[model samples]
Target: MAELFQIAGAGDPRLRDYTDLRDVSLRKLLETERGLYIAEGEKVVRRAVEAGHRPRSLLLAPRWMESLADVLEATDAPCYVLDEKTIEQVTGFHVHRGALAAMERPEPLSPETVLASARRVLVAEDLVDHTNIGAVMRNVAALGFDAVLLSPRCADPLYRRSVKVAMGAVFSLPYARIEDWYAAPDLLREHGFTSYAMSLAADSVPLDAIEIAPGERVAVIVGSEGPGLTEHWQQAADHRVTIPMAAGIDSLNVAASTAIACWHFRPR
Candidate 1:
């Protein structure tokens, strides 16, 4: 069972991991340097732990302790008990879910490793919004896609906001960064997967019109929020695909478009 330490103030040094939760830049630096990520809410925390992530510690409001008792009993990490007000002071927001845990970040999986057995994959290029990244992961996982591959410049899926928005979907899905972003499509092709770049190009075909052969490996690519897929990716991809939309609606949000594509290309 974990040791319980009552924390009276937000300034307690031991609560450093829980401090300034809303500051993206500081949190990124601290978490990256410390090899940690924060999992918010009871369910996300439990999912993170169950997914084999080691908890550095847990910060919980008194009322949440009983709900997460099983988690506490299973780990040796200390628990810092705090009141809602102090919790708010430390985390910079109202944690209505009443639970947060700092977890040891695992080593990233290699693109090759993630692709070795994946048949249906989603590729994200330069998606800077943590929310979109998280939503994409959730959509991919919920739709039964095999994995997600991100470009080198994509947002960190393990960021606190991404983890929270994903509702722990990041834990269940297999994903990795493609360091050589330019050659991503080539890599997919080398792995025997046909790449479909989601774009608004004149030559793009309606997503429903594309046919997938039985037992075929496939990859669907979505780009950054502002600019869609790059010219290089569009040219390199096996096909340029687009969702048919109403007049004047050029595109949907990246997350929404990805969900639609994932559903269409899901294994038959």
Candidate 2:
């Protein structure tokens, strides 16, 4: 077992990193020498561990020491126990969950590599919200999508809030970014995938109208919330699909739409 440390006051410099709370980009976190991200709550940490993310350390309120003993014993990472008041002060808010972990970021898989053998993939274009990114990954995992592809502007799937909201699914799902968005569909096509762009344009076909061939490679392209598919992408796709919606509801949330699309196109 590694050494255990105790935090009794917010004045300790050791808690500096945990302070300065603001949204931090995944790129910024990755660039850090420590190569770490904060994952909060026992459930998220446990799921992250189960998904194979390496933990650097665990921080907990003094009350959780015995309850989380098994996890502490299982790794060489140091465990730090802090008083409730200090934890709140250092973290900038009260955390009733009582546990958190810092984990190392793994090497990213390339989009081409992630798509090489996939039968189905979800392509995200500039979906910058961490919550939506997390929700999309959860959908992909639930509905059997093989991988996720992100355009250059998409949110980082490994962001702390995303990891927590995804219930740690971010650690389990295979994903990668494509630097050139326009060229990716062509590459996917060359690799035997038929691209389907999701949108609400008049020319778009209802998902029910298409016959998805079994064993054929397919990729679904989804744009951000406000702008649907880019005109160039829509023109380039083999087909355009739209979900049927009730009157007065402009459209589903991008995450909801992603889930429906994944379920519709899941492998038979």
Candidate 3:
């Protein structure tokens, strides 16, 4: 059973975990230091719990309590009930979904661990946008990729914006950061995976033209939104691939291109 408390004001110390959410730098520091991440919306909260993340506390509007009753019953975490206005003041956002939970951030999986059982993977290099990271994760998962690997500089997939944008898909996908960004290609190759760099380099071939043998492990690499893949990655990857575009259109958004590539290279 959960303990319910009525929060009458926004300045309550107990609400510290939910404060200044819109301040990305502050929230990143606070969340990382506290080993917690905020899950917004009723569905996201439920998904977080379902994915084995323990809740440190829950902030909910009075009207949402009934709908999340079952979730509350399953945990003894403190539940702070407040009106939407105060909730907004505390969070620095409207929080229209009416439900938010501070969940314990799980231990990150090692790159080797993430690749151990994955036959199809998506590799993101220096993708700093949280929304793009979330969208890429969702695309990888939906298109049947087994896992994801992020370069050290990639944005945190568990960031609030990322989580909300992913609609909780982050919880279901297995991903890890590569400490040695330069050796990423070697790492995948060692695991019996052939890496295909998604690039617009002159020598790159259309993605649809690439052929995969049955049971061939594959990794589709995408880079940051602006520069695309780094020159090193473009050269180090086993193959440079491109999604052929119409005249004047050179490339697609990182997430959109990833979806197309993942679908094309998905396991047969």
Q: Candidate 1's residue-wise lDDT over 98-205, tens digit each? A: 899999999999999999999899999999999999999999999999999999889999998899889899998999998988888889999999999999887799
* Top lDDT hit: 3
**On residues 1-268, what C-alpha lDDT tens digit does candidate 3 reach at each position?**
8899998899999999999999999999999999999999999999999999999999999999999999999999999999999999999988998899999999999999999999999999999999999999999899899999999999999999999888899998999999999889899999999999999887899888999999899999998999999999999999999988898986799989999999999987
- The TM-score between candidate 2 and the true structure equals 0.92
lDDT of 2 by residue, 1-268 (tens): 7469876677776665566435364335542656777778887877777777777887788777776676777779877788777777776666778787877778889887898879999999899998999999998988889999998988878776677778778888899989888898788898899999998997789987878987889899999988877888888888999997888989999989999898889988
Number of the candidate with higher lDDT, 1 or 2: 1
Kindly give the stretch of ten consecutive residues in candidate 3 with the minimal lDDT sum: 242-251
Q: How would you order the candidates by lDDT, starting with the best? A: 3, 1, 2
Per-model root-mean-square deviation over C-alphas: 0.8, 2.1, 0.7
Instruction: Estimate the overall C-alpha local distance difference test score of candidate 3.
Output: 0.95
**Candidate 1, overall lDDT?**
0.93
Model 2, residue 89: displacement in angstroms? 1.4
